[model samples]
Target: MHHLTGHRNIVELRGAYEDRHSVNLIMELCEGGELFDRIIARGHYSERAAALLCREMVSVVHSCHSMGVFHRDLKPENFLFLNNKEDSPLKATDFGLSVFFKHGEQFKDLVGSAYYVAPEVLKRHYGAEADIWSAGIILYILLSGVPPFWADHPWIREDGEAPDKPLDITVISRMKQFRAMNKLKKVALKIVAENLSEEEITGLKEMFRSLDTDNSGTITLEELRSGLPKLGTKISESEITQLMEAADVDGNGTIDYSEFVSATMHMNRLEKEDHILKAFEYFDKDHSGYITVDELEEALKKYDMGDDKTIKDIIAEVDTDHDGRINYQEFVAMMRNNSPEIVPNRRRMF
Candidate 1:
């Protein structure tokens, strides 16, 4: 299971005991009871804390994906708190729904807590991405104190219907029947609204490109060292080197794109997109998807945004047909091709 998970966020399975009658597994015990407990106790968490939690969860999911292990059961209750505090780092636990992939084989077993299941999983033809959907639910809960997809009065129907009947049945029905009681119905509904979006993908791609140097579509030791200047992530050089070595698979002194993507793939696109879009919207005063020169100038005044010429240059470069205006398609094309050589950095790293 450890070899299959490949993600550091999972609790390490040191050993297991099994007999004809019973079985036990020795696993890392996190002091924190569970993320669900913290959320219920506190009601809500700050945006920064929410962001951090999402970051950690996404990272774990990404690792599971690369190694072909899918944590089909991911929810606040399954998230083990490493320290007995709300701020403690989280470790995803409960792999009862976990599966190891075979070539061309996709998951069909309907397993996991219902509230956090992915929509695709409901149809029964799903893969590792389903885990991503569950992580998104946790993110919504941490940030908004509620899940995105649920119905009103989840516990009992005023109309004398079954206890399991809820308006948010579409997603919940796919959870292998893990629906919560009435009080927690709204929590699931909240998750549906916080689903990841395309804009979030764009922002993450930029982050990935900035960290991945040498353009081998991956981040190796040398690339990570080079990217430190950009991330401003403070840590010992030795530690960073260790992380790089741990991720390096070919012993070619570099980490490939797969390794880097796998490491960060679990990041919640919604959280990233929401913040980035606000900034973009503020700069685009005219309500247009693209910012104009005048609007850009005003935004620069407020943001102390880098050199004006850099923005103009970007707009022009993306206007491949030289039409003097950048559209969503052009902007996305440029964003996807993030290498400096492919998309020159006209401004300073900052």
Candidate 2:
């Protein structure tokens, strides 16, 4: 909290005193009370008001992410207003479950409250994106006056048993209504569901380590500007800043491995997809949008990939429709699904 004191949206840590037995932290006083209480007192809030509050929440979270901090426990009760005024800024408090993380690192500890806890956090191996999930929960609660998920909700079952109660239709209706009201909130919800596979994450970590020339966990601006050219690409300072801003999540001046990976992961995917398409085009000699058994044999022969039988077996597995040919969709799926093997051996056109 002390390190994060300067941020307007965070509760200021005034001072701290440590004694033999214990330590005491003197923090800012928010007379207006908890955010939940304030919301109840308002009885109802306009979409504009909710959006304003949500923006403030994102700003603070963004600041925390920029600094490599994660407030694992983010809930309405943790937010307090400075005063009773209409514009009393909401400040995030309670750092008990908060943690600082290096770039590309993953946390396995299940530390947050259930309602605001992200799904990946529960599974472990979560990063800064967990906070974004919590923020989305807060946004849902702000709009609906109830959490989107609840411990007692009938839809949830223990022991993997089917629930006796019918799933609530109202919950689905509310979700639809919420999505209709806030498009950005819909995007945030989608982000909560987005996750990189373990293999992709591992590959990204390796990529980050390679770019970190000094072996430092974080990438400096100098390294970013100079290193890309070594990979046969050049980026201007402004572009570098934009990349940093997009990936840095924590406002820290340097890019941690996580930031580096997150920022470039999409680019990496696109490049792989391009390569897959090119490979497909190469095999589709007749421009028929499909690779027949003959084309597959010919393409495999060019690379000395496998025996005739081996090539046929490979195509047989990918030919889901059993049309005796692999269409562009099937070909792309095969490449992506077997990327670990295919990508490493992919022939570079250049």
Candidate 3:
């Protein structure tokens, strides 16, 4: 909070007193109380009001990020109106879990409230994007009066509008993965209930789009957490984190289209001779017929796959012939294995 002392939306820290046992902060008082109470005292506000609040919330986020600070735990209760006036500025408080971060740094500590935590945080690898994830969820709650993943809530059930768009394929991987079942379970139970149409997966509305404000062409971890509830699937935050790490085949910290399809596509399609060769050719640039360690790093680095050491480790393990390079035969064998595309674990991966 001291780092953000002069920000318009952040609560100003007047002073601090430190003792042997603790440190006390003198903060500007906000007599208007918590945001939820304000909403409940009246009712859900108009979309215009919600839009205004959303902008303010995002501004708080931008203020923090611009100052190299990350508010690790952001939820409705952390926001307070400065005065009783309707237009009083909302101040962001509670820096208990906030931390200063440098660009390209990744935090491993998992600390956040249940509903607003991003999946990457749970997976123990995240950056500034994680805080953005939290703010987006807060925006979703302000707009809908309920968390997006909380399918059991009255607001979720009461919302009966048809889905306006088909979720992206990457989003589908997240929704299906988070549905508390592996693909085999769905197949075993004859569960086509997700409206398994190739054209559109039904029963979800504006789910992924809520946080894709930039439409940057990749699935944000924030979108996954916010969308899971619409599918009526609830899981422990730990499981949600695991679901992301499990599906992120490239280890790029975000799931992309190829990673999604590589992780979930049918075996027949995956093992097609042409498909396997194409996959190899992707890495064996220059049509060299062999994936040298340099070739491996170059290909994987393009996807921001992982560090050089991890990429080299993959090359070493996949080169079954001990040739310091991966040939078509070795590549095919690895791809044919039960689960291969996993970047973290190569002993049993694609």
Candidate 4:
């Protein structure tokens, strides 16, 4: 949980203390009460609302798996709402039963609440799929207002026997939907990558050459200001400085082809659109749909990107709208047109 604290749906770990005899952890406060209690309080919950809740729970579980962590024990009691508002956010809590596992590894443990435990878990051989099974149980309870299986009457099927336990239609539907969504996402990403190929890079190279008014291999501040207007866009000196500071990773005081490509291709290389959006959110800070100078400074501080003056200049270059902030569209354009070079790397899964 400490390593995975930044996710909105996972309870944040604020602090920790360890002593000779005991350990203490401080986590975010959740005031909306337990999932079951909140559902009961409402008395009338719709399928749509239940589905939305299930979606969030699945998302949190997916994040956990992505980070190579497994909750082991997932139940309604372990999830809490941040507030008592109607649209309060839900957060997964209690890492006491969590464990880290590597890709293709399996665990042998009789862990988790009886009602939510998966059959594989009971069999003493399980992986991240166990958490998905538990999530399905939570979805069952969310829609039916009662657990599908209980301690006294647990789900059971003999090994090698045809399944007799009835599966929840809602859960089955959700599984199919998630699989379909995953497939579509992969296809879309492939298409986007194909569109931004070497041919596209060649076109950008031509644009870059046109901007290098001095016939130099790099674009200086003066060239940027004069060249942008030819493309029907005006950029301030400060903004040009910011752009150079951001793209000029080698501290060359100018934007080179590698730096330009890095800035433009960074977001495109991402496998999911949500990843790009999340990257944007990191700099947005206030959820304002636009990144202000202050927000850019805060984000840059993390990367040790540049000093105050240099950071301001990069923001000026990125803020194409001239509205003193970089909106999502402007940000995306900057990413697509002026990105750093991305080295090919394999995606790690665990």
For candidate 2, lDDT tens digit of each residue in 279-314? 566667888887888877775554344466756676
Error of 2 at 224 (Å): 61
Q: Each candidate: what lDDT?
A: 0.56, 0.63, 0.62, 0.63
lDDT of 2 at 13: 91
Candidate 3 structure quality by residue, lDDT tens digits, 205-240: 243343343566555566656645454545567755
Clashes of each: 19, 10, 4, 17
lDDT measured at residue 288 in model 1 versus the true structure, 0 to 100: 70
Q: Write down the RMSD of all candidates, one decimal each.
A: 21.5, 23.3, 20.6, 24.1
Q: Where does candidate 2 stray beyond 4 Å? A: 151-155, 158-350
lDDT of 3 at 323: 80
lDDT for position 83 in model 1: 82
Model 2: lDDT of residue 208: 54
Q: What does the lDDT come to for candidate 2? A: 0.63
Best by TM-score: 2
Model 4 scores a C-alpha lDDT of 0.63
Model 4 TM-score? 0.43
TM-score of each: 0.44, 0.45, 0.43, 0.43
